[model samples]
Target: MSTATPQKFEFQAEIKQLLDIVIHSLYTEKEIFVRELVSNASDALEKLRHLQLTEKDVHDDNLPLEIAITTDDKAKTVTIQDFGLGMTREELIQNLGTIAHSGSKQFLKALGESGAKNSNLIGQFGVGFYSAFMVAKSVKVYSHSWRKDAPGHVWSSDGSGSYEIEEVDGQRRGAKIVVELKDECAEFAQDWKLKEILTRYSAFVGFPITLNGEKITTVQALWLRNKSEIKDEEYTEFYKFQAHAHDAPRYRLHFNADAPLTINALVFVPQENTEKLGFARLEPSVALYCRKVLIDAQPKDLLPEWLRFLKGVIDSEDLPLNISRETMQDKALLDKLGKVITKRFLKLLEEESAQRADAYNEFYAQFGIFLKEGAALDFTHKDQLVKLLRWESSLTEKGKTTSLADYVSRLKDGQKEIYYLVAPNREAIESGPYLEGFKARNLEVLFCYEAVDEYVFNNVREFDGKKFLSADHSDVKLEDVPQQGEALSEADVKDLTKWLKDALGAQVAEVKSSDRLVGSPALATNADKFASPMMRRMMKAMKKPGEADEPVKVNLEINPRHAVIKKLHALRAADADKAELVAEQLLDNALIAAGLLEDPSRMVARLNKLLESV
Candidate 1:
């Protein structure tokens, strides 16, 4: 058998292109080649072990089911051997020498479409065995089939488009891939370097992997076992090992679902949000896996971008297991997986909030902004995300927060709107004029402290039949409270508004007596039927191109009950221009309170002019 001449075959054109990329551009990190070779070895071993149970007699049946590695730094070689199902002569030709027979053409087409970015998709394709060529000058595979009748073979390749398969006698079951390292890849032959790669990527392999005489893969695949059987310390240890995190998990969701897809997810919320402390924005660290092998270490689309703060593993057998993220051939399937996982995570948060209030609150305190972001951006999960939002309301004391559910529960019988005010802090919202009417009407207003709240509420629209209404909005009309010390007749109020409108000119859309204002002299309301004044200002700040620079035309709503209006009615009659300054000053102050004031320089000069008159 050793004298049998080698039969040679050329790789298909597309396979040649794939080989070139694998050797040059497919992987950014050279260490990954070690992972790919070992993963393939493990798969072969698993296949043979499965065959052993079904068949009464097997070739080399008693050989230990494990992977062994040996390094020869002086000889510049590394060998990975597995006692698993090996290849017969025909099997070697089909597996190692032929690519057109495999699905390599389709794989190459996908690579061309996605370009170089998604090389991470390689492992999913089951073609990872080729990755060894990246670090190798030449490769030789020695194998024997699990079938006692089958003869062993050796496949040799230099990755120059062709491979040779020859009969080799006295071969044990499974394959041993020997890589003669390229001059530049000599480091892979070092015992310490090879061990590091094996430990980092292949540590949890179901079968034991030994580097020389020392074992590297010792950690059990905890994600596959029942959660009840696992100890807390074990989970913590696995998380630390998987996520490379120093702090223990703040929250963990380890669940197995059979519906929609077969999934085993171990998701964790970190003990602290690093981004909240001014660190770099967290990348999508949730490593995706299939069975026990990793798919993508950080798949950006596996979960929504807003979930970047989470760290864990989501292993789904239902996933296609072999496709680029950008051109996920089964996009609908992937989307279904994403939706299911996101829904589960949201449900987990809801459960925590209900059963473990303080802990959930702590998590919300650190990660609430991400939830708000998802609410504003991901319409698919908008309604669910909105329910998850938490903030202090005008009725709640400092640091105390209420959810939309709680706010909606307390709404009055006829209250047709869910009121909210976006302010910098609790002090700002309380001191601002917007809350006065809501407070007087005994209606609860959600106090939104984040800058993005304005954008979020505008899109959230409503909850439970109550339309979202910003307390600062101009069109708000609260039920009138008992009039307090007001002496302005309707006729006097009409004349004052008409004159003020003429004086303010283009700045005022329509000046009228306010129904929403309780104590303020005047308030600026948005004239745009669709966008509020605050919305317009936000749009402007975003530097939306081609938008008009025309000043925001606001309807000036004046409170007839306020002492300032009572004085303003006489002041206008006594001194016209002096009254004009006070009118503009009152409008500017109202604008400032509404969080719409931009250029305050003119307001300062006008205030000084009013001071000179006094």
Candidate 2:
């Protein structure tokens, strides 16, 4: 009920400028107005809570500390009311008429200067309230001051240039904002739309919130709560609610840190990796929040790209957000926060691997590719990510894995390089010529079965001071092992290599007698120092059709002690034509074993020719 004639006043010049930005460009999403208003409501509620501790005389003392949002499609209006610290007529003018006089901005400045009073109020720039003009055709604020002596007032604005204020009676203790939405933005007046925006941005606000008399904020901000008091079932429920997950998480990291930056994080590793199930690339699921209000639901810069599979919440009180709160103003601070989180997660993994080996192994089996991705691309956390990677080696039985640190621990005396072989599977590696020499010399070779393994190792390069060396690489030189059988003389080997080199021409980069071959007569290794055989095959596969591929040339290493090499050495002089066909067929066979043969047409023809000579 109005008690006096309305007094109209022109908006302060700075506020008019700010209103234009808020209405036209300050925010990318128009629905952000709801988030801004709700945050302000939360802040007001917090102030009233503090006032209750000191002041005995207050208006609307019986009102609960909560927020109520009501939307009416028929009227095309949204009403949001908070029973918190309301404003007097002069306070309203000071807080709303001028941009610089924002109570929240002053509070923030005081917090900055006084070293953080124990408050979680999030309105920092004081410009959030103006965001309502984005959708509102007319706005009205009804407020009653907390002091019993102060009178209630209603402020009205069309956000054009001027506004009116009227003294009113029977007003509540806090503020109630009614937004008469524009015709084009009438969708915001729907209950469903408002509910969605509220649930997304304000679900975890400290105070209770209700929409049309029904409770909206049911889930607590579990990340901010102490971990010791949280039960496992509560965690599972929160995970299900936040992640929209059906299966319980395999691992969860809940931690709070104060140094460098204040952070509260709850991250989860799902029981299954959906990206591995042939789904589209996972988007960043770890939402970014400030003081429990969502800043970005899928903030690309909050976490490294490799952590896209992780799903949960990361809330920080230390964020310095812009007026709109859509983006962070300081990228360096965000990066520091991300680093802290990544390191903490890796530490959790380390502890899990040490204390619960079986569970960690199971998690690794499901999500190891993501760690490999991080190890390859994210240099800042690569060392920690590398330590968390797991692989099955020659010494380990199938289905069992060992970490890079464990492999380093078991390094043979005088072993200077960590050896690994990339193949399609353990069976392919065990049956191939690459592992024969290492196995015979009692050296362990890690079995890498994924396509990304070689690329990851290439990027990682080394771990624990030992460089990673591919077993099938051309330049790899293994220490001398005592011979078990008769071998070709040095002179005989030189002659055979010269003849084979000439016979194979451009196909063979070089031909030499090998110390790294035990049973196989010959094997092909890529002569290119930059790319492995597997990497070359992958590159060829990815190349566009009709694009010419570079010729495949390999260094052919022949086992001098094998009967096939000795027979080929003799046959070259006896039957020149037959020896040429045998040599070509041998190179094809080696290429097939290395998974480098894209077409076997020439090999098929040469096999028939060899059969005819026999």
Candidate 3:
């Protein structure tokens, strides 16, 4: 130690400016000071570790590279110590008293320009240390250089305008910072408070960390580890910790990519979708990290909203963070990073569906809505998401599902469209009149039961070069199947259709003998190509009750060979009133089957009149 008076120096203009910005306006949370100081310590230790490799004459070579934190509530002070590359008197003045000579700033510029993926270096801005002044009344740095010939020094500052530095004795070859907390900021000196901050932001730091002599950084950074080296239990444990979940994850995707952006991601699909259980909407749980230090825990723009069900960590070295690291600086680069993660996740789902059909089906049963949402919304990843969609089909058992790729592979020769039908359930679809034609022709039709099914198909439109066609759509033209039983004459068929159109009035858009009806007497198809029956019903339900519905008109298609049509043909002239009543009843029945019937009052009265006539 030097037996001399302490040398006081005026603070550099830039250092004063930097302190004001950091303490007053830069950080959103005052607790961020803990993360910044700990990060700086870790960076110092990393530098020392590197020096150990090449330098033979190192000071304090036997001290372990670790960080220790102590909090004294009675004294209202917090002390953080690290056995790292401490600074000499001149270096301290350059690094702390002046912003221009900051060591971390130069390292950041050099690392960035070199495009190096040094995961260990996190101190990009050299001013992270000044964040302590946010909650500090005073800060003292006790440091000794790693060089054997250098003497120890202590720098003191109240962060007002100037600082004093003087030599000290018996100092270790590292830096120890003691922050005398302000009266209002005494919370930082509590054991529990510091523990919470350290676990959240510094749990994944490379070096060991202790809070009041107890190890707090116990959770490993599994995302940066090799996937093959990780075990199922380890991944499950990480999922539970990261997601704050009770149940094990249903699926986990751990991968690293260098292209497009250097990424280390570990994403998981939860055991169930809480949103589906009628809970509040889910938020994005996939936290964004850089170099193993968390940047944003719930970054909204990190993933698409539909993928809110996923939970995990995504750490990338390529992110360009602003000075505070509270938010990302480059939104375009952030978007690219998200796309990379999303594409990888969708690919994982595809692989799961192909290799583990039963398990994947179970996952789909719970999480399929997310995929459907992505398919219907996100255009960039829609093509990949479409391959993961599943639905029940006529060719599969009641509970079994088929993928679009599987359906396309099974398509009949020369077919150019994939057909689907939305109904209340499998039984409703199988028994409905619309499916009779497809079943009769031995063609498969996907059965969709969810309310969003129609909307999804409407947006997806096509897949694998084949257009999506609703089985009951008015524009649908199915190839003819062999006719069975006696058929009505063409003249009689024309007469019945014409009478039906006139007798039903505005209820019928057009009446025609059907090519798409078999084993069923008749069916109704939407006249508006854009509005399917299910979609119209959904829209109508969303409106206030008793709100008059928009006028609905459907094209009624009748099977000419069915006995009811033949009898109607004979009875139309025999009794015109009875025939008119029967025609109205037939239209009502078709509307009910199509899910387009808004009111049945007129049909109820007409039905009673027909019964009395009988």
lDDT of each: 0.80, 0.87, 0.86
Encode model 2's per-residue lDDT on 568-605: one tens digit a residue. 88998899989888888888888888877778998888
Tens-digit per-residue lDDT, 1-614, candidate 1: 57589988897676687788777776767777788777778877777777777898888878999999999999999999998877777777666656633445556766555332233344332377777888888999988888899888888999988988888888888888899999999999999999888876777688988888887757887778998899999989988887888878998888899996888888888888888899998999888776667667788777888999888888876665333221345666767888888999999998988898888889999999899889989999998898888989988889889998999889898888988877778888888777777788788988887767877877888888788877766668778777667558999999999988888888878889877677677777667634554466566778767866657667778888889988888998788888899889888987787666778999989988987877
Output the number of the TM-score-best candidate. Answer: 2
> Model 1 — which ten-residue stretch has the worst lDDT?
116-125
lDDT of 3 by residue, 1-614 (tens): 65558999998776776677778887899999899888889888999999999999988999999999999999999999999999998888988897556643433453345432333235732457888999999999999999999989999999998999999999999899999999999999999999999989887889999989998855789999998899999999999899998889998888999997889999999998888899999988999988777898989998988889999999988876644567455678888888888888888888888899999999999999988998899888889888899999999998999999999999999899999998889988887899989988889999999878777888999999999998888888989889887889998899889889889888888999999988878889988855677788777879897898788878999999998888888898899888888788788788888888878888788777887876
TM-score of each model, in listed order: 0.86, 0.95, 0.92
The better-scoring model by TM-score among 1 and 3 is: 3
RMSD of each candidate relative to the true structure: 4.3, 3.0, 3.2
Q: Rank the candidates by TM-score, best first.
A: 2, 3, 1
**157, model 1: CA deviation in Å?**
2.9
